[model samples]
Structures are given as C-alpha cells and as structure tokens.
Target chain A: EPEVTQTPSHQVTQMGQEVILRCVPISNHLYFYWYRQILGQKVEFLVSFYNNEISEKSEIFDDQFSVERPDGSNFTLKIRSTKLEDSAMYFCASGGRETQYFGPGTRLLVL
Target chain B: AQTVTQSQPEMSVQEAETVTLSCTYDTSENNYYLFWYKQPPSRQMILVIRQEAYKQQNATENRFSVNFQKAAKSFSLKISDSQLGDTAMYFCAATGANSKLTFGKGITLSVRP
Candidate 1:
C-alpha cells in the first residue's frame, strides 16, 4: 500500500535555529496535515494544507511555524526559531478522503 | 467543535483473549468519521480500524472491530484473539465536516503471553 513518507527520521538542532521537516504525502491524496506529540502527551494538531494554502491551524501554530508544498509532492514544515518546548515527534498525514494515513514521523529535538 | 475521550489509560489481556478499549466522542456535526490508530513501541502511527457515522453496520478489519453507538456518541474498539503483537498505545480520533482530526489521550494495551 502507498504510504506517506518523511525525511530525517530524527533531528537535533540548537535552540533558536531554524528547522525544516519534510514529508512526501501519498501521491493521490489531496489534503495534508501536520501533528506533534510531546514525549508523554497527546498528539496536537499543527496545521492543515490544501490547494497550496493553509486550510486550518491550531493556536499552537504560531508565527514561528509555516507549511509549504513547494512541489507537487513535497510538504514541508519550517520552524523559524526552535524552542526547547518545540521538541517532539512530528507526524505528517495525507487523506484521499476522511481516512488519513500517517508517516513514521520525525522526532525533533531542540536543545 | 469535536472532542474524543479515552477514559482508560491502560489495559492488559492474556494471549488469545478478547479485549475492548473504550472511546467516546462529542460532536455537533451529524456527519463525521471515527478511527482507531495503533502506536507500538516503534512510535509509528498505524490505522487499525475506522467507522463512519452514517453506517449502522459496524466495521470490522480482521480481528479488529468497532462497536459504534451513534445515539450515545460512543465508539469502542474490540480486539479478538489478542496476540503479543497487539501491545501498543491506541488512540481514538474523530473528524467532522472539516477534516481536522480531534484525538483522545490514548490508552496503552499490553498482551501478556
């Protein structure tokens, strides 16, 4: 089965540095989303992208965060400046319909 | 707005036994979708089963089945003939007209040999 794929399975970055997490959603899926989970917390929605624009975002998705589908296949999340609290497992998902499929996830560590 | 709740934090079952994980959702929208995702020690999120609100017939995938009660706004997962591989954290989620998913805190299930 086709699945969402993400790059840089794990990343370690210095606080205040910028980081970009990349994802290649399932080719035919039209909607894409980003979610994060703190070490022991529930997964929190970050943003949703469709038609090259942000469709919805959570309060946690502040100015520091931005998502781009630079190419037809790549969806990337950029954090202008990383904070210690930003460290978590970031997941990328895509849906052809109501059922969305997830990637293995990228673990981000901002120290 | 939509919210999903998983009251049980953890559970354990003997191999080959049946286990049920509870999940409840509150949603104003009449049309929506509910899902159960499994996250093993690897931390990879995998879709185990899904139920559509309009479908009265529960959905069953292999040994994973869902008991969906639209009136009570409840959706629970039942795993039959549980195996050690079933050990994982299960999350119940719901999405409405808007495709953003609201997820519960998740419950950890351990299958004992």
Candidate 2:
C-alpha cells in the first residue's frame, strides 16, 4: 500500500534556532495538513492547505509557523524561532476526501 | 466546529475476546465522515476503518467494525478475536466539507494474551 513518508525521523536543535519538518503525502491526494502532539496530549490541528494556499488554520498556528508545498511533492513546516514548548511530534497528512492519511511523524526536540 | 470524543482513556481485553472502544463526535453538518486510526509503539498512524455519515449500515473490515449511530452522534469501534498484536492507541476522527479532520484524544487499548 502507498504510504505518507516523512524525513528525518528525529531532530534536535537549539531553542532559538529554526527547524523544518518535511513530508511527502500520497500522490493523488489534494488536501494537506499539519498536526502536532505534545508528549501526552491529543493531536492538534495546525493548518490545512489546498490549491496552493492555506484554507484554514487553528489559533496555535501563529505567525511563527508557516507551511509551503515548495515542490510538487514536498510539503514542509517551518518554525521561525523554536522554543522549548515547540518540542513535539509533527505529523503531515493528506486526503482527497474526508479520510486523511498520516505520515510516521518527525520527533523534534528543542534544547 | 466539530469535536470528536473518546470517553475511555484506556481499555483492555483478553486474547480471542471481543472489545469495543467508544467514540462520540459533535457536528451539525449532514454530510461528513468518521474514521478510526490505530497507532502502535512505532507511533505510525494506521487507518482502521471509515464510515460515511449518510450511510445507515455500519462499516466492517475483517475483525474491525463500527457501530455508527448517526442520530445519537456516536461511532464506536469493535475489535473481535483480539490479539496481543492489536494493542495500540485508537483515535476517532470526523471531517466536514472543509476536508479537515478533528480527532479525539484517543483510547489506549491493551490486548493481553
């Protein structure tokens, strides 16, 4: 079966540095999304992208965060300046309809 | 806005037995979809099953099935002949026209041999 793939299974960086988590969603899917999960918290939606523009975003998706399709296959999330609270698992997903598929996720740790 | 809820924080079942995890979602839209996803120790999210809100019949896949009560706003997952390999965290989700999914906190299930 085709699967969503993410790069850099794990990443560690300084608190004030910048980091980008990348994902390649299923080829045929149209909508893309970004979600994050704190160690013991529920997965929270960050933003949704469709037609090359952001369709919707949550309050947590502030100016510090941005997402771009960059290329035909690569969808990335860039954090302007990371903080300790930014440490978490970031998952990229895609869906043609309602049932979205998720990637393995990138575990990011900010020191 | 939609919200998916999994009341049970955790559940356990004996091998070969049947277990059910509860889920409830709040949505006013008549057209939508519900889904169940499984995450094992590797933490990879796997799609377990899906249900279209308008479909009256519940959806089943092998040992996994859903009890979708559209009127009651409930969608639950039942795993039959449970195995130790079935141990994982299960999440319930709902999506509307925006095509964005709202997920529940999730229920951790342990199938003991």
Q: Candidate 1: where is the Cα deviation over 4 Å?
A: none
Tens digits of per-residue lDDT for model 2, B13-46: 9999999999999998889999999989888888
Residue A33, candidate 2: C-alpha displacement in angstroms? 0.8
CAPRI-style docking class of model 2 based on DockQ:
medium
TM-score of 2: 0.98
DockQ of 1: 0.73
TM-score of each: 0.99, 0.98
Please tell me which predicted candidate would have the highest DockQ against the true structure.
Answer: 2
Candidates, DockQ: 0.73, 0.74
Across B1-113, the per-residue lDDT of candidate 1 in tens digits comes to: 99999999999999999999999999999899999999999899999999989999999999999999999999999999999999999999999987998899999999999
TM-score of chain B of 1: 0.99
